[model samples]
Target: MDMKIMRAIELGKTYRDGEKETEVLRQINLEIEEGEFVTIAGPSGSGKSTLLGLLAGLDKPTTGQVFIGENEITSLNENLLAKIRGKMLGFVFQSFNLIPTLNTLENIELPLFLNKIHDVNRAKELIDLVGLSHRSKHYPNQLSGGEQQRVAIARALVCDPPIILADEPTGNLDSRNSKTVIDLLVNLSAEKSKTVIVVTHDLDFAQKAKRVIHINDGRIQ
Candidate 1:
């Protein structure tokens, strides 16, 4: 049998605001094989992003478990989870979370720098892959929204993690740029054999995935 890179068993999340409780996700059971391209789609408050966070080990589920490979992440502490995330997962956010002061190349290299990995060649390759080689020296504020997002994608791939979790990657781009970013992500899974799970609202983009998981009211539909 093929390896399952990510799995969620009866996963759930709840938030408390004083006397009230909000159930964001409930009984989300899922399994993603290595190199699969999966898209999670839903309305704004459907808990897609919340599920992404739990899968990435950025947040613990309120109930049940999340497994990345053989490790049960819900039981791990923050430090260990951070280490696992750095080594096993890459993340891209909707807002280009690039450092304003850092140039494109620098922002792409930041993750490696934090992990004490000195790999300039790998960083350059990712920049080239994202077609941002010409703009490598530009700062985030100096680039257009599309350019910044490309830089963010390059940064996510710098670590070359087996799995990439992208939250509304094209939410800030125009139709043209959105297609570009989505195509790149598809190539990452098909050509490079990376497991990619994306949370998106775009039906057109969701249709490109190998599997589309629709969630509504915190439950899979």
Candidate 2:
């Protein structure tokens, strides 16, 4: 049998506060095929984001393993994880985390710079794709919330990573903006054959995905 593009086997996560231990995720067994668009829906503090982080190698799991393509991410060190993240994963957070001082062009270029690819034209193309070409010179503070979020999307796509893990991407948007962003994400993922994993509490948003994995109290149901 062929190995899946991504896999999580008996995954678990725990956090400690003072003398207490809080178990966040328990025995998460998942497999993601290449080019799949998957979503995880759960209530707050149900470990949805925690799963994303572990899968993306942004955080370490207390037990079990996570694999991206053929790479066992949990076996790698932090430096290796950073390299893998640069080459394989993209993330979109609910906060639309953009640097306030950078203009659209500069913000989109940040990822490329981190990867040491000096290509300004690539950044311009992403700005155009996200419908922010006209705002290329505008700072994040100058753009509307929706526009800023679009810029964030552009930044995430700049590296052309194969996997995109988005956490509540549209949570801060209005209805129309939410639709616009979600539609753009779906379209982009399909066009690029990217694996898109979104975590959201919105039933309508989750339903649009090819597969929706429901989570309650840290276990997939």
Candidate 3:
């Protein structure tokens, strides 16, 4: 049996401001098998990114449970959640949030340093894997958009996390770079046996997933 790497049960999220409340996701139940590539697709304002954040343990659900491997993360405190996230999840954002002062190698190794692990070898391996080895000494401002995003992907993988969550990873790239990023993400699951989940509004990108979960109005459609 394939391991159920990630699961969400009756998940929901709502934001409250003053007396107004806005419910974004509701009763979203999902399961992702180990080594599977999945995409959550929906129109803008349909809560796709919200769901991704929840599953990544970056945000807490207003109601329900989320399981990453055997850990039910919905109720884990910030410190515990951070610990689990560091060990099990790698996230790539559409914005490619690389530090301005850090070079590609430094950025990739940041996660390792955060965990008190000093392994330049692992960081270099990831940079090479992402084809950024030559640009290791280049700062974020010194690289092109595609290169920068690649660095972000390498940084995400440097920790050797089992699962990767990307939110609209191709949103900032041209067609060619988008294809490159998509191919890398696909290979992570197909070849590396890592569970990869992406939240994207682009139909083309969503189609790349082995399983596409269509979400609309906070519910799976």
RMSD list, candidates in order: 1.0, 1.2, 1.3
- How far does residue 44 in candidate 1 sit from its true spot (Å)? 1.1
| Model 3 misplaced stretches (Cα beyond 4 Å) | none
Candidate 2 lDDT over 61-127, as tens digits, reads 9999999888899999888888989988889989999999899899999999999988869999998
Per-candidate TM-score against the hidden true structure: 0.97, 0.96, 0.96
After superposition, the stretches of candidate 2 with alpha carbons farther than 4 Å from their true spots are 1-3
Candidate 2, TM-score vs. the true structure? 0.96
Q: Write the per-residue lDDT of candidate 3 for residues 69-106, one digit (tens) a residue.
A: 99999888889999999999999999999999999989
lDDT of 1: 0.91
lDDT of 1 by residue, 125-208 (tens): 998999988998999989999999999998888988999999999999999999899999999999999999999887777788
Candidate number of the best TM-score: 1
